[model samples]
Structures are given as C-alpha cells and as structure tokens.
Target chain A: MRSNSLTADLQPINKNIRKRFVLSRLHSLAGIVPLGIFMVEHLLTNSTALLGREKYNEQIHLIQSIPFLPLLEIFLVAIPLIFHAGYGIYLSMISKSNTQTYKYERNRLFFFQRVTGITTLVFIIYHVWSFRLAPVFYGTEINFDLVNSHLENVFVFSFYVIGVVGAVFHFSNGIRTGLITWGVTKGPASQRIAQRICLLFFAVFGVLGVTSLFAFI
Target chain B: MSAEKVIRLKVKRKDQMDSESYWEEFAIPYRPNMNVISALMEIQRNPVNAEGTKVRSVAWEYNCLEEVCGACSMRINGKVRQACSTLVEKLEQPIQLEPMETFPVEKDLVVDRQRMFDALQKIKGWIPIDGTYAMGSGPLISSREQQEAYKFSTCMTCGCCLDACPNVNSGSPFIGPQALAQTKYFNMHPTGKLTKNERLEVVIGDEGISNCGNSQNCVEVCPKDIPLTTALAELNHEANRYALWSWLKK
Candidate 1:
C-alpha cells in the first residue's frame, strides 16, 4: 500500500513520484535543449574566423544586429544556463562522491561529472564576462582584433582551452547519462551504442572548439 | 518548586492510509532508563496529549524489543533508527519521531517495507537448492569469505540504509544498499553462483546498481554496520564484467 499521508511539520514531504520524475526529466532536457544548442551556435559563430577577419567581424555584427538581442540572451541562454547550473550544483552538493570507495568506471564517471560541472560553470562565466560583457562595459569595438587580442594573453588562451574541453566532456557525458536516466537506453547493448554516439559527439565538438580557439591566434 | 519531571515527545500521526497526518505532543512522567519504545508504551497506556486532552493511542510496531527483528525502525530525533535501541534519556528533549519516508507508512510509526523485500526477491538474495533433503557436506568456503559474508549476513533488512540513501527516495526505482549488499553475499556462496548471471542481469538494468548515486550515507546509518558502499562498489565492478560478457555472447 502506497501511503499518501506521510508528513513532516517543517517540510512538506513529497509523496508524488510524478513530481520527481518531471524535475529529473527537466534537468536532463535543459542540458540538451537550449544549453547544448547554445554551445553549438557559439562555436559555429566563432568558427567564422577561419573564413577571414571580415567574415568573423560580420558574424559578430550579425549577432549584435539581431532584434531584441538582450531579450533573446535572457530567455534563451542566460536563464537556461542559470537553471541548469543551479540545479546541477544542488545535485552535486547532495551527492557523495565514492570514487575512492568504488573504483569502478561508472563510479569514476559520476565523480567526474560533478567536477566538470563546477569547472564548466566557472568557464562559462569567465567566457561570457570576457567576450560579451567586457566589451559593452568598456565601450570597445567588437571585432576580430578584440578576439585575437584577448587570445594573445597566454593565461586567457589556456582558460579557453581548458574551458572548451570541460564543456565538451560535460555535454557529451551528460548525453550518455541522460539517455539512461530518461529510459531511452535500457539495456547494455543500447547503453554501449549510446556511449559510442556520445564519444563521437565529443570528438566532433572537440575539433570545432579547438579549431575556433586556434582561429583567434 | 515541587514538580515531577516529564518527557516530551512529538510524533507524526496518521489514522488511515489517505488521511492527512498531524503532529501530537505528549508528556509522560519521566521514568529513569526508559527507551523510546518504553515511552511509546506509556503513551499507549495513558493516551493523553500535552494539551490536557484525551487522544487515541499512538500506533507503532515492534517484535524483538532488542535491535534484532528490525520491525520497530523509525525516525528518532529525525534520524532513522530502531526505536527499541534509542534511550529517551540519551536523546535530546522533545524527541521528534517520524515514519521512514522511503517506505509507505502503514500507521503512525510502522511502514510497509515490502519494497526492500521485493528488491531482495529481484536479486534472488537467497541460495538456490534442489530440495530440503540432506545433501552431503557443502562446498568449502575460506575463513576470509566466511568472515566477509558474516558482515552482510547481519543485515536485519532494517531499511535504515534505504532511509539514509538520497538515491532511494520514493520517486526513484533504486533497489538500495540493503539488497545490493545481500546480493553480493549470496553470489559469493558456492551454490549461489549457479544463478550469478541471473542476479547480475537484474543489477545491470536501470532499477539495479546503476541507480545508486554513491551518496555513502547508507553506510553511516546501517544499524549492523554492514559495508554497504563497499559491497555496492564490488557489485558494480562485477556487473560491468557480466554486462560485457553477455554482450559478447549475444
């Protein structure tokens, strides 16, 4: 018998499994839907540098020219990232990393997920601050030279490299786990297939991110 | 001031399965060396609240008054433990008691722990044998194996591990530490290995070992001090190998 009446005076205990299911599903969806898409768009836009300096500047101008840019940033990128990062931090805080206790592959992956999540959040903040906000606040022209000047600093370039790698792992590993958590891949064979697909994703995106980083050089 | 000391207890109570639960505070004459179960018994006798009103007797369950049997497991001072072992003298004042949330409360303090048992069944947590007819001497187990198995054998199915596990909440389908440890125990036995692949199949799935978030809280609250996290770790490794083997065979 599923008792629906369990209560704690201080906290309202959730007896509904559906609420938890929805929250978990939403957390996984947020990782993919807009956040992952945003990463793709950001990388593709930056890759315009490979074509020419003018092409890269034009791409940046095109993004700046979009109607209601601030609104789109808020609704599409910032909000979803905040939600994803906030919920992800909460999950990491509650989770106990047992890599020391359990040296299994999945156990290590679980620990790595939390580590990369924290790094990714820090990287994303640093990236947005340096690239997006600093230019507006400093009243500097947004151009390929600005991007190249920032990448000229060794430390700044290192941060981008590490951040890009962290983002790739987080996104790729997240997809593999999301497939399982959502019940999309239930068996070992299906999970292996999903893992291979995620690895391929990591490879493709890793190349794009690294290529974009080098384009600024 | 000529007054008698009183024990204050706040218990979460529900009359029926679907009814809303309410908190009721009770004050009983302080008895020296009394445990939570004893105070609960006093409440049963008096059936009065701290508000100076008559109330229904608080319902609870118990079998062995000692730590064994595991039937009297409940939240004592917000920590899931066996009520029989928690001394009211040792607990902080205004002892807060609640039913374990991981299971459905069948009454005020008693919960239906059938899910844990169901998980045990799913893992085939017992040794398989042909019949009760006397077989000759069983396969020899090393002293180390026996010692390791003994630790897991002490698990009373108390549900404390599940209660402390963040991953084993009602919404999740995690089979929890208790059953996972038990699965390892049985799988270690000579005869139990006959069905090792069957047990491994259950754990390699979504509801099995994969669901464990490795919170490590389960090991801390285990009444018997079973190496739950260690067993889960070992089981995870074993399950991985078994999964690959199955895939290759397929």
Candidate 2:
C-alpha cells in the first residue's frame, strides 16, 4: 500500500491547485513584510497629525497623490491580503489528513498560528471597513486630521488601542511563525526564542494598548 | 515494611470529542504496586470520589497497557507521562492528571491526534510497493540494520516527542522530530531508498526537518527511546548531499 511511503505520495499532485495553495501562503507571508512597511508609514503619518493635524492632512494628500498608488495597493497589497489569509487557513487544514504529528512544537504552533490567523483576519476586516472602506462609502473625510480632531474621542481612541494591540500580536506571531515556515531558528534557542518572542510580543503590545487606552481615557 | 499510603488524584474527565471537560478527585486505597492507570481503573470500577459522590468515571486513552501505544500519555503530577508506568509510590500526594498540552482536547485525555498523523502522511513515512502485484519478499537487511530499523519502527506516534519539542507548537509549521526520524527510517530501507531523495526534499523544506532545534527532549520523552537526534543528524547529511547533487546536475 506504500503506507510507509511518506516521501512517495507528495510528488504527483497537479501543480495548478497546488500552486494556488502555495501562492496563498506566499500571499500571507507577503502581508508580513509590507505590514512592517505600513507600520513605518503609519507612524510617520500619525506623528505629523499629533503635531498639528494640518501637517498630517497634507502628508496624506501628498502620499496618495503618488502615481499609480491605488493600482499598486490593489495588486500588491489587497490581492495578497485575500490570498494569504485564505490560503494559510487551507494549508493548516490540509496537513491534518496526512500525518500523525506527535511532536510538541508542531501542534502548538499550528494551533496558535490558525488562531492568530483568524484573529488577524477578523481585525484586518474591521480595520479596513472602518477606516478605509467607510471613508469611501460614507462619503466622509479620509484625511489624518479628521481622525485626530473630531474622531479622536474616547471611543475612537479605545478602538485604536485595541486595534494596535491586535496588530502587534498578529505582527510578532506572524514573524515568528513566518520564520518557522521559512525554516529559521533551531533547538533550545528556537524554543527559548519562540517563548521569548511570544512573551515579548504580548508584553509590548499589552503595554502599548494599556498605555494608549489610559492616555485617552 | 511500612505500607505505602494513599495518594490523592484530581483527574480531569471527558468522554469524547465535543464533550465538556470536568474534574473529579479520588483518594484510592494505595498499594505499593499500584500504577496510575491501575489506580484509575480501580476508580473506574468503583465510580466513587473522595467526597463520596457517585459520578461518571474518568476516561483516558491507553493500549499495550504497557505504555507502548502512547495512548495513556497525560500529565502526571503536572508532567506528561504514561499512566501505566507512572508509579503511585514515586509521586507526592494529590497527583493531578491533565491532558497533554499540544493537542486539541477531544474529551478528557484523547486529543484529535490527526495532526501528527497528517505530518507522517506529508513525509509519506512509508515504502512504496508496486501495489501488491504479486511482489515477493523484496530485499535483505543485515541484523544491525534490522536492529536499528526496529528501534525507530517502535514509534507509536504517542506524541511524547512533540510534547517535548520546542519547534513544534501551534504557531509554527515545523513538522517536529518524529516524522523527520521516520523519513530516515524509510530512507534507510533498500527499497525505501527509491524515495530517499523525495523524503530528503520534504525534510529540507520549510515545515520539514530543517526546522528541528535539537533540544534533545524528544529523545528523553520517547518511551521507545528512539534516537531522534541521530536520525535528524543523518537526515541533515542526506539533505546536504541531495542539494549538492542537484546543483551538480544543474
């Protein structure tokens, strides 16, 4: 039955469907690197808003005015977002029927990876809907000044606190898991590092969230 | 000789997947010879707790009632081990039984272990035959090879290796140590060699063997004491050879 053929069966599946799944994971990973880019860009944008709100508003217009920005976002950012999240969910489920994984590390990581994926998925959906899509659909302002001037009420600040905290968890976990996916870290160091990173992730994000929430409250 | 006294047990209980997890405590009449599983079985027969309440018996997994099946593995005194082998005499009073942390709690002790099974599937951890087409007993193996292969084949996928491994967790895609060892086991077979390259490729990939951190806990927790590190080390050699060979071919 080739029941012992752990190496045999993986060779011959049609590549197209397989490719899509692969592409999907690649997309999920793509979001991580760009997420870093987004964080930097966002911090820079928000710093100006905190300064006077006018500079932040001007900064947003100037950035959006760059050539083919929306086109780049649609292809590079948006498409990858949909594929990566969807594909990772699929891959995690797909491995279930194939192996009797008996190690601690695999099961633990796979479980949390799925959980964080789902969390990030839900959070991203909410963030995009509230900030990005809402501005277009509600025909309201999209500039940074509006968010700081009127929208910076306690409720909005609370959301930001929660939102940033969620983003931080997702980012750090995504980075750690991404390394595992790309095959970095080894042995006790890896384990120690993963633990450290998780604790670090939680602590940093928790502090940021609590501080931010308290500042507004 | 002084008689070994009773030890308390607060066992987490469940029946099947989708069942709720609960706890019950029992103070069994202790015998020096009593193992945790035997104690549990005794409790099962009695169905009475230390509080004198009639309750549903605790449910856990076991087979080979000898710790070979890895089914009886759970946290004993807050550490993971086989109940059949966990002697009551060695433990402190009030020993606790908790499910292994790495798997989804299917009921009380049984988890949906299909994840580990799927990893084995990913590596195909097998020797492909031409579909039982009247193939006779295929190849010869030396006693040394037989002995080594026998050791690895003893792996019952009990997940002790995974539980002890750091690379394995819910957040990463690493395939853990057992499957990587299985890859070498099959790769060692003369017939299995046909797929050695295939296994090597998988183990070398992202969720594959390259993710191993070599904490060596996998070896310590393995009831069979399979040399998982040795297997992984050998696989690493093979992976390098395969990569080099492919480069030469290019």
Candidate 3:
C-alpha cells in the first residue's frame, strides 16, 4: 500500500529524470551566461547616451557593423532568452507561493523573482518588437533621434521605466539566488554577502539604466 | 494575577482525511512552565469545548516528549515547530494550532508523513554496511569532518522544513529538503561515499535537487538548526559536477 501510494504520487515526476536535471541546470546556466551578459552589454551600450548622442549612435553603429551581428544576436542573445523565459514561465506556473504564511525574506524574494521574471519577459517582447524587429522590417534607422522620439511620450517613458527596473531586478536577484542554486555560496553568511553584492549591482545598474533613459529624453 | 487565569486555544480540527475542517476552542487553566504538549494533554483530559460540552478527545501523535522524536510538529501560532518545545507563556493569547498543510491530514493534527519516509527510501538515506558478521573498525575521520557532519546528523525527520518550503506541497513532486540534506549526510560517510554517484543520480532526478527553488525557508524552520540550505547548495554543486562528468563521458 505504501509503495502503491508512493508510486502514484511520484508517477508524474518519474519520466525523463536525466533530461530534467540537465535542462534545469542549462536553464540556470543560460540565464547567468548569455542572457545576463546581454543585459549588461545592452545596458552599458545604452548608458553611452550619457556621453552624448554621437557617442551613443557611434556605439550602436559599431555594434551594427559587427560581422554577422544578426547571427550573434540570434544564437547568443535570442535563443538563450527564449529558453530562459520559456522554462522560467513553466517553473513559475509549477511553483505555489506561500509568502502569506512563511513571511521569510527569502520566501518573499522567491515570489518576487517569479513576478519580475514574467514582467521582464513581457517587457522584453514588446520592447524588442518596437525597437529591434519593427526597425528592421520597416527600414527605419535605430539612432539617437529614434529613441528620443519614442521616449517623448509619457506612457512610453513610463513603460520603459517599469520595464528597465523590472529587468534589472530580475537580473540582480537572479544572480543572488543563482549563487545558491549553483552552490557558490554555501552558508548563510556567504549568501548574505552575495545578496549585498547583488543588491549593489542592482542599485548601480538601475541608476545607470534609468539615467540613460533620461539621457534620451 | 488571578488564580482563574486560563490559556485559550483555537485548534483547527478535522475528523478524518476527507472530512471538512472546523475550529474548536478550549480554555484550560493556566499552569506554570507548561509547554504546548502539556496544554494538549490538558485538552485530552477534559475533551470539552469552550461552550462547556463534552466532545471526542483531540487525536494527535507524539512520543519522546523531548523535541528529538519530531512527531509532535505542527503549526503553533502560525509557525511550524515542535509542540514540545514551545512554551505557553511566550505565545500570544488564544494560540492557534493547525496541522501542517503540506501533508495530508490523517485526522486533526495527525498528518501522514509517509512521503518524507518514502523520500528517504528513494535516496537510500543510510550507510550500507554488512552486519551479518562482526566487521573490524570501519574508518577514522578527522574531528573537523565529524563536526560538520554532526550538524546534519541532528535532523529528526521533522516535517517543519517541508511545511516552511514554498516549493514543497502535495501537488509538487519535489522530494523536499529533508531527503536532500540526508542525502548529503549519508554521502559524507566513508562507507557511504562508495555509493555517492548512486545518490547523486537520485539527487539529479525529476523529484530531486532540481526541484528546489532555493527559497532558504527549510533552513529557517528546522528545529535542529541544521544548515539545510548549505547541504542543498553543496548537493547542487555535487549534482551539477556529476551531471557534467557523465555528459562528458557520453
């Protein structure tokens, strides 16, 4: 009877054991590696706007002029992102939040991580469509003036602000949890230090990304 | 203080596994140095509701009145803990008691913790030694390793970690943190190291380490103060390395 109940309970999870482990690790790896690196590079590139229009445009042009830029974006940025976001959505769906009862800081953060992941995913989809895909299909040049015009609308500006902050929060918090997930920070003290470092990263990059948005305005 | 000082309790009760749950209040005369168990024993003795009528006695399981047995673990005042250790004086008025929702309640506060035991069986959470014949001394261990292992060794199979964990629930197949930490504990043994890969295989499986969301609540609610998250993080490293090595071998 015990075995029967146990098997019934575990039957849903028994299939593709090795595959799940590999995919889960790959999901974590993809987030921190390609997707995380892209966010950093993207933010730093945008922050070039603080150096003035020509510098920002020059950076964009330099990026655009790279040999096989589309391939690099597709393989490095797009695919990892698709997997991360897709798997992340599935993970979020499976996870049941108990923050109401547990009320621990990490438990609350765990709930927020899923929230920000979905938020960031939605924001990225729309942002990419507006700025990257639409520009390519419509033969519009992506320059300083283009971004400046887009941010001119208050609603668009607000959306960008929300999206940027959500994305930053997702990335920063992801690093903190990822450190634990990957076993880099073993103890609570080490985990706390990692959290502080990640928070510092969030504050610095959050200010930089938001300031860059203001730069375009 | 009045001699009539009473300790009020609001207990969430269920008659059976399928029965709907209801609240029953009890007012027992306050006693000095009374823990939740003694208060519960008082309730068992009286079996009367606050409305002053006789009722069936509340059913719960407990043994080794000390915290070590872990059978008396339940939600006391909204926190999952061993009822034996929680003092009445430290708690607020009309203390709330509920069975852990993570497990199926058998009746009242009695939950079927069979899943936790099943997980232990799945991970082979023990050192395999042939005891048929008297064997010589196994191996020597440095005190440093012993001290680290001793921390995890204190776990008493309490369900508090699972109750606290957001990722662990009836709907989820996650083996939860207790089994995961025990896997680490067993693997640390000299004899158990021989089967480390076998355990890692389970650890990397569907209901294994991958299911952990790293919320760190398991470590927070553990009665033994076991560094559960530390074990989890270490296991993650072990499982990852094992997965990578196997992948490379293929």
Q: Best by TM-score, which number? A: 3
Clashing pairs in 3: none
Q: Considering DockQ, where higher is better, how would the candidates rank from best to worst?
A: 3, 1, 2
Interface RMSD of each: 11.5, 9.1, 4.0
Each prediction's DockQ?
0.06, 0.05, 0.54
lDDT over C-alpha atoms for residue B233 of model 2: 56
**Among all windows of ten consecutive residues in candidate 3 chain A, which has the lowest summed lDDT?**
A5-14
Model 2's CAPRI class is incorrect
What pairs collide in candidate 1? Answer: none
Best by DockQ: 3
TM-score of each prediction: 0.62, 0.59, 0.94
How do all the candidates rank in terms of TM-score, highest first?
3, 1, 2
lDDT of each: 0.80, 0.68, 0.89
In model 1, the runs with Cα more than 4 Å from the true position are: A1-217, B131-135
In the range A1-217, model 1's lDDT, one tens digit per residue, is 6433222112221224224334444677889888888888888898899998999999998999999999999998898889889978866775545455335565566677889999999998988888789978998898899889989999989988989988998988888877655446644566668879988999998888988889889
Residue A191 lDDT in candidate 1: 62
Model 2 stretches astray by more than 4 angstroms: A1-12, A16-24, A88-123, A137-141, A190-217, B1-27, B32-34, B37-80, B89-156, B161-177, B184-194, B200-250
For candidate 3, write residues A1-217 as lDDT tens digits: 5563322232333337777777888888999999888899999999999999999999999999999999998999999999999999888888889888788899988999999998899899989998999999999999999999999999999989989998999999999988977889988899999999999999999999999999999
lDDT of 1 at B206: 50
Candidate 3 chain B has its poorest 10 consecutive residues by lDDT at B122-131
Q: Evaluate model 1 with DockQ and give the value.
A: 0.06
